[model samples]
Target: MGRPKTSASGASKRTEKDAERALNADSKSPTSNSKKRHATKETRSSKTATSPSTTSAPVVKRKRAQSEVPTADDVTSNKRSKTGRPSKDQTKSRSAKSRESEAPALPAAINEVPQDILTVFVFGTGENGELGLGPKKNEALRPVLNPFLDPSSPDAFHIVDFACGGMHTVVLSAKNQIITWGVNDNKALGRQTDWDGGLRDVDAESDDEDDTTLNPLESTPTEIPAKQFPPGTRFTQVAAGDSCSFALTDTGLVYGWGSFRDAQGNNRFGYDTDGNIIATQETPIHIRGLPKITQIVCGDNHTLALDTKGDIWAWGYNEQNQFGRHLFGRQQDSFVPSQVRVCRGNAKYIASGPYHSFAIDRQDNVWAWGANSYGQAGDPKSAGGDSAVLRAPVKIQPLCQKKVTTLAGGAHHSAAVTAGGQCFVWGRIDAGQLGVVFTPEQIQDENSIRCDDRGKPRICLRPTTVPNVEQAVDVACGTDHTLFINKSGAAYSSGFGFQGQLGLGSSDDVEVAALIKAKTVRDRCLIRTGAGGNGSIVADIAKRN
Candidate 1:
């Protein structure tokens, strides 16, 4: 079904609008069902929040090819020239060899993960196991210790990196192992958790002690079998979305599982015709017919991959125009991963908000596309409302001057970290999504910054710095809140926290940047942070001897 149309009155959450659609009136799902919404205001948090709102800019041209120069039709058939290009399997083999001598060197910190052993901590409610804190203690109003995954614990996994999806988490260990936890309703776990035939008693959540035993399979972290990938696969990175997961091999191949959801909830996972339509992949499958890949980023329902040749490949939900290219007919063609025509140049770095996409080219130019209902795509022209979506990737004027090293985005807001260590946030501002505050005179520009009936800022259409957050090393975003990690190894946050995502020992939302000073995280040197949905997570290590 197509999406619902929203007004320019400034509401930016898509979930609120979806709830307005009753099942009876919309019996059969048509793509346009994404259009019937009754809400006139946007909320930073919602129980059924997943899809992002719409907003726009002048139409930019869509461009992307599978390889160096193959047409969209050739990419659909998984070929280069369809006549002169090598076979699919042969193409990968040859590309790997050629990439060694041809592909440009990536930036020094692109996709780099922490090297030290991590002590993971989770905050907020994990009703869907988003926190990975297990059943007995699912709610963490403050940042609490997660002894189950800590390095000091016996038989610890020695986690080095992790990713946060809408309600799940993916971890990478020192042994090149990929461990998954949380919601698996869509096959995002990548492995069967029912080997025992019956749901096992785990954690003993009841206060009756000896009388209590219960374990939800998705609550605990478990490794996907090595057999899922070829022998000696050597996975280097892992990524997750609302209902999908992907792992990248050092050899530049990609394997993925789970299904990408459409506006009406059903989405296909494979790259074939309707006869091959699979609702959700029960297990991990090697994604075929792609060039050698170096990195992959997952948005709410779309996946973007950067091949060694420097071109970007995209697939999954494109209703919000995340692909930056024209998509005709149904989304069946979207299931096939193809090159994205991004910014008329090769990208050196890429990032994703839940419903939008961002890329930084080798020249340090930033481009954004997709859902802009709340101006999350970095285009001021599209900041007014749902109809302002950026259909194609366009260079973000403010960020073009800053050498952005990293970016993290949420439902309708985004944060960027530049090589100069400055952190800038923009988009939906009324709900405190932006970590910094602005004065009345600072936001007087109407076309760029939207204001409500009371003159309170609704959105900031440009990259504005978070006043107190300095020397930011990294940044992470939840559905509405954001977490900023600094060089001193301390983390700070701002925005909606009715679910305790702020990690401030309370569910109250904060407008300005606040230090995460729970009893558990205090004095601890947090090395990294991850967030999504209604939760937040941070990992810390002890001081070295």
Candidate 2:
């Protein structure tokens, strides 16, 4: 499967057309039988209703089906036994037999899979059809299944992981294969084929021309090759920021693509010491001059990498010191990757929010840096004068002893998960992305919560724990919302509900909080679910055996 084909009208209308196309295509394919399985599964799940906050705008309600939840036993049992752990050979054999017996008796539609795919596919603002879905020119509010993953074909490859940036998306397959679509304005598409010509310059002068010429290149999905690496070299992970993309190869080398030169060509962002920025390679280019990289992350205009030794390196836009090394008065683009001294210890993970940065050290302590305009720096007392930004990493005192194990950075907010599975949030709470589901008591506390040095309300700038939550396994942040998946696979969402990103059935505001259930499940006990977002919420869950 290739990226979803764009409709005749353009990207803005792509979603409506894409949905129709998917239905039509599935109708014609030999997978229609699976539709009944999905329908049947939906009828067994329970649904929960959450009250909308008074502050949010009116929104339409959407019905959702509940999904079967997976158990810890499923995950653990699926692992191959090395030590003396219980074996699931009997369970695996039974599942194989059941699947064989239930193999589609007739043709089915690809979209009719019984299992809900939780992955979120987000395309940035495609004002010019840069997202490649066609000229609809807006944010995609839901996960658009990658057409490249053919559900009908048993041998079809599966996307193991994916990441999205301001305008592009990248997916790494189970076979170590990489696929990308959405937004190639900066040559971020990687490589181009005969179908994908180099960047198409839209001529403003010809706007009144025929529809064919209005946006000739807008609807096509192009495949990019990683040429700088060895032929057939596979990637372990891929990430994208505002305008650039990075891929970490299995060999431990990093490759970059997209706009290299900054607004001024003198110093480009995303480039290495050797000037290896693939402005138009249409293929992956190895990032020159770096040791083996263990992981990579990208901010709006910067990049961060963690080596096997746990050392962090950063480059690109430093206006807000997102690089976590430069001092306030001295800031400039780092064409080459440089060590971020602040994360010298055994760092486990690193994340970059829109204009801020975060990291988890060996002892599970969280640190923050960069812009603090909305107290995103995690220090309420620190005075971020109209322009005071931390050029380097600063430890968040409140969470130092909490044993933080996971971290998520949203556009302006951040979240952390403690080892005990408790969630704590901080930074920008205007949209309630902080999960501050304000009860009457909490609302009163909000009234008393002291303001920061700038005389602004300190909406828990420090790590304040979320109430009535446990067994959380994963967490994700969107531009103005947050989501969590419990060990049981149940999902909870809070924050900006304008786009229905919370999946609470409506776009109404949720000041304090709410746990969401899909419409498919009737009995909540057997259901499980997961959630994520690009511009909207994407969730999934599997049934336990």
Candidate 3:
């Protein structure tokens, strides 16, 4: 299909001419209008002298020209007069003016909102500038005002959506621009190899030192240089895997980079040989053989893309059955995307953990498969069962009849936010990933909340309610923690806190969602969240006072 031609050029020219004419006409001095009238008379007399046969018609033309003030559009469009016909000289003048002035290619800048009250509060970890703060900082146990991305700051980075992979991060700005930071080993940052060499060198040094060495995290958000994406492509979403990245354009085309496993030859990155594993793909390549992609989710090594027709297509790592198919020990990875079997109804959303995959149907029912070692699939029958793998999609009963809106997956846990603002969690709870009380009263006296000999919450086999949180609008999951934002723009988190991913002041893990009362430049609230291995990030869409 082809795109329709636009009339924007002509419309823009009309608007510009209208503005100029208005300003010129607003002059209160009588001399300006009088000069135009005198010019009109002189022009008419010159036409009469030049053409002897039109001398008799000159008196009639002068009366009509003086009758009304000429508008810019009237002169440029060569529009017929309202009362009398225009002279040949007037028609020539209009044609010449139209040819001399052409519309601008770009539109004028529009200020959408006031910058005075716009602030972004960042919390959790910044091991590699994941917090959008400077490279000098590492951890932020509490929320801090992000000066670098502040609207009033010199950088003025305004982000709309954020995605985190194992070691890198991708963000979509309000202007449909993309900027990346954190790990760039796989060229997930989308820059050329020469530009990434310096950052990788510093990362290597940081790994060797026990002391916190500042990894050259692109401390500032850097735009994806031109030519990476096709012309006129405006990105709307992005997703990251362990060493791979994905981006979605406004037209539903998907582009991918980096290595899920080993790349072959020219398609691969870093090493040139066919035997050695490819490290990075500096540029994004379109994912062919798929329908228009609406959303993408990445596990540690696998990827799931949701299409407009409500079907799910998956590729990448399948060693642990992440792709819902059996390799029979023959292969560990899939280079081509294939549709997931056994999915029913229209798929609305998809999410992935390090080894598990999940989808929500139009009926609001949640279906899960892939690794379920800790019952992250929400299958009560698999609760503490010997086998830990579910090879095909299975509808979870606990989430049935509930209108689920969004989902997030951690390494071994799952989270869902419902229409009524209720949050449901299930799966590995040893690190408090379930965010539920493990008491028998909350489990219907079934003792379902098992524990190891060390006395820690083991796992949740069913969808357990996250107590006291309401109006939940969004949810995000890290490797072993969960974060949620309410309609009030308040953020809360639970589970592992060793690296301060939970955003609570203490290092001790919390079994329930706790409010992240971090500070910001203005009265702002958290509107979105993103989670990676041991780090979490929350975004604030500044609210007007």
Candidates in order: C-alpha RMSD to true structure: 14.4, 17.0, 25.3
Predicted candidate 3 versus true structure: per-residue lDDT over 97-154, tens digit per residue: 6764653343222212122233555556554445556545656787676665565553
Per-residue C-alpha lDDT of model 2 across residues 6-69, encoded as one tens digit per residue = 2234335344533533432311111111111122111211122123454532222212112221
- What TM-score does structure 3 among the candidates reach? 0.69
> Which candidate number maximizes TM-score?
1
Return the TM-score for candidate 1, rounded to 2 decimals: 0.76
Error of 2 at 305 (Å): 0.7
Query: What does the lDDT read for residue 241 in candidate 3?
Result: 76
Expressed as tens digits, the lDDT of each residue in 1-545 for candidate 1 is 01212334323443442242232121322232112222221221122334446442222211111122111111123456668867787778678768755766532333344466678888886644556665445678888876557776545566877888776778887766788876666778898754221222233244453231113455667677767876556767888887788988777788899878876757668743345777788688888766777888898788999876678888888877889867766534887777788744477787898778998888889999987877889888767664567877888888896989998888778999987889989888766878777877778977557876667677888788987888988898877788998878788988877668889888677899899887777788786888867667888764221
1 versus 2: better lDDT goes to:
1
Question: Which has the greatest lDDT?
Answer: 1
lDDT of 2: 0.53
Q: Which is the winner by lDDT between candidate 2 and candidate 3?
A: 3
